[model samples]
Target: MSDINRVAVIGCGTIGMSWASLFLAHGLEVQAYDPAPGREAPLRDFIAVATTSIGRPVPADTTALRWCMELEDAVGNVEFVQENGPDAEDAKRTLLAAIDRLTPAHSVIATSTSSQIRSAITADCRHPERHIVAHPFNPPHLVPLVEILGGADWAVERSTALYRRLGRHPIVMRREMRGHIANRLTSALWREALFILQEGGASVADIDDAVRYGPGLRWAIMGPYLTYHLAGGPGGIRHFLDHLLPGHVKRWAELGTPVLDADLEAKIVQGVLEALGDRSIADCMRARDAMLVALASLSSAADDAQDDLRGDA
Candidate 1:
């Protein structure tokens, strides 16, 4: 019943490969295109690893994946196109314009751009109405959040349904912004984190632990709003605003915006390297994915328990 069955992935980088793996896992035929020479082997390897990490077996049908050298060949017959090209404005604009010209009028083109706004990328395109931003978190196969912005009402609705079918949590923004919603929040926190490191308040490992073992754990279940609603005790969010809002404002004023100068950059690099210790990047990624899987399972179980309690009530 879904309008999207066959998808065209226009880049084979990490994000693109992850999207391909997810599409394949959902039994959708994927046509992939990348200009990099000898990319098929590495892409396949990445897909295999990502599938394992997400605990989804690849479809037995090898025919579901078709590698195309030309951009026109990739988007010719696909119902949806997911563009993972470079984040640069000019490059994305050119790529999107090409896709707009080649793809069918009804086929929606979603860009996996994290920072660039949809309007900017689609500015040169003839069919900007069908173009939209569908930014996914890192390792799209594991993360459920996909931030969607721009597009016509029909296109947005279609994309929402498609993403829901793929078992993704898609948020439709009312308007376009540089970093969308999630990335802006993350950037704010990251700025503060960098400031903390520069001021010698904490090491990289300590800062990471402060998040992972603290708010990050709760964030997996409920966002900051609901978390603070609970913090208001029995009186709820109203009480929270009355008592806690002033303190938050004061703290916000004191928050630092650290510049990533040479010294700070070196400190960060050294700190991260120290944190990694003997583990290679691959090893660290595998470990991170394993932890993510565990956390996802726990979150699911908790949700089910909460639903049961609600039903009993």
Candidate 2:
């Protein structure tokens, strides 16, 4: 992080805008750029309105930020750069090469890339060791997990410190891999859910209910393994593993691979539509986002209290 006070956000799409909002809310000077001509105004406004985390209303003061016309101008003096450009490997390599030429050698470069492996993207950069992957969950300002991978150990430490400064939790990946931990876990769940839906065994809403009213509630506080440990009573993990391992394997085997036939696609669309009847997608997304914002605030406060107690102890 190198005590990052200035950050450059190279793309201003949905994820990019959210990253900019997080930076601004934490009082960082952001220089955002997108080559598209009509983007500056709305992107700036989106960031301005997205600063509700600090309880400061929009249009209060965005004097610190200046949207730039060129990528070079946007990143000229920034201490850190959060790249949210296209996910294509060639495009990322090209942009990173351009950034490597312009940005100071010491500045950390983070990508919001969801799937691309960091090692592959940073291979062409001048300062490959300084380039790290910092993938935040959707609406980066609200969700605290920033999945950091690749780079040197020092780079990960610095990136973690910077995210901490911005009121986020940085989870370091032990290895460089595409789709890191969270996304991999999410994909596993999604794959099974899709399979079930495609087979007409479960509706979209039913799957959501299984999560929202069940595991999701428990997962909010502890992960699956810990939850399972708790479920094992006095015997703990050893007992559960001994008895549950076979059943787990058997159940997983029962879930055969899914093929997306025409009927399945139509069923998926129908189920999704039925679950979201009459509600505009944008409106539904907004509602979900607002809820996440409040949840994140509460979680942060809880974590701070825990930290304080540990310090006292």
Candidate 3:
């Protein structure tokens, strides 16, 4: 939205490569950097596979990104930088210092950090005002939501606009909370999933199927609150809450925390491997992510249609 076409991706690991692919798919020039030598070829291969798998257009005149050995070189001439390094505080502090010094004043500095808050990472930066945490789901190129946090209203507004321009849904957090919104919600679900597994109430595949077939279907179009409101029939969410919430809370209270037992961990690993079978984990994740991307695109289209209908009304 700000003519910010060029993007720099620092740390070209799994998340970094995925972010790069998203930018490149949208015809944005990407400059990438990683300390590992010969990583460029593998990164390029990942982009190719992701683009094909997601059915996203990889332009014929596609300018393959410049891979730099130095971090500053990657940030050069770019309007945005998406950092995807290790989650260690010291590592982030060092990287942010360098990015703060090198990046253009107006460039929007974002991180792929899932756990850290914006303030923690950007505290050392000279222009902390220009920094925001833009965390995307795994396979960022595919998932539509980019959770944006930090800065004042203007910073959040600009970051939201930029992500929207890139065809992403940027959910701006009202506060700089740890783990942000999506991941926090995911953590809640995962916590329950662990309880279910530990209680021997559900298998891994059963839990997966429950989501892929049940509430996940409605979640594609609306938030859980809205879904519950609809479930209330003519009475709305308050009525449903009065009747249903007590039972829900009771069930949640009864669930136990997962024990960090080696046997359980081994069983979990075996279960996942059995689910995946011969398919590589990377390949399986990519395929699953591609479906989610298409689902998100469809949902967005539906939202647009509903808005248009409302306007006509």
**Winner by TM-score:** 1
lDDT of 1 by residue, 1-313 (tens): 3668899999999999999999988889899999888888888888777777778777434788899989999998887999999999999999999999999998899999888877787998888998889999988888889999868988888888999898788999987777999999999999999999999999998999999899998888899999999999999899999999899999999999998799999999999999889999989888889988887788778888999999999
| RMSD values, in order shown | 1.5, 1.9, 2.1
Mind giving the per-residue lDDT tens digits that candidate 2 earns over 1-313? 4477889999898899888888887778889998877887787778766786445444555586788988999988987899999988888988888888899888888888888877777778878988888989887877788999858777778789989988788988888667888998998888898888877787988988899999998898788999889877799888889887778989988876678789878888888899888999988877877888778777778889999999999
For candidate 3, the per-residue lDDT at 259 reads: 83
Q: Please provide, for model 3 over 1-313, each residue's C-alpha lDDT reduced to its tens digit, 9 standing for 90 to 100.
A: 5566788999889889988888887777899999878889888888887776667757544666777889888986777888888888878888988998998887878877888767777878988987888888877877788888777566677778778877788887777778888878988898888777877887887888899899888887789899989888898999889987788898877867788688778767877777777899778875787678678778778889999999999
Please, what is the TM-score per model?
Answer: 0.96, 0.94, 0.92
Q: Specify the poorest-scoring 10-residue window by lDDT in model 1.
A: 52-61
lDDT of all predictions = 0.89, 0.84, 0.81
Please report the candidate that would top lDDT against the real structure. Answer: 1
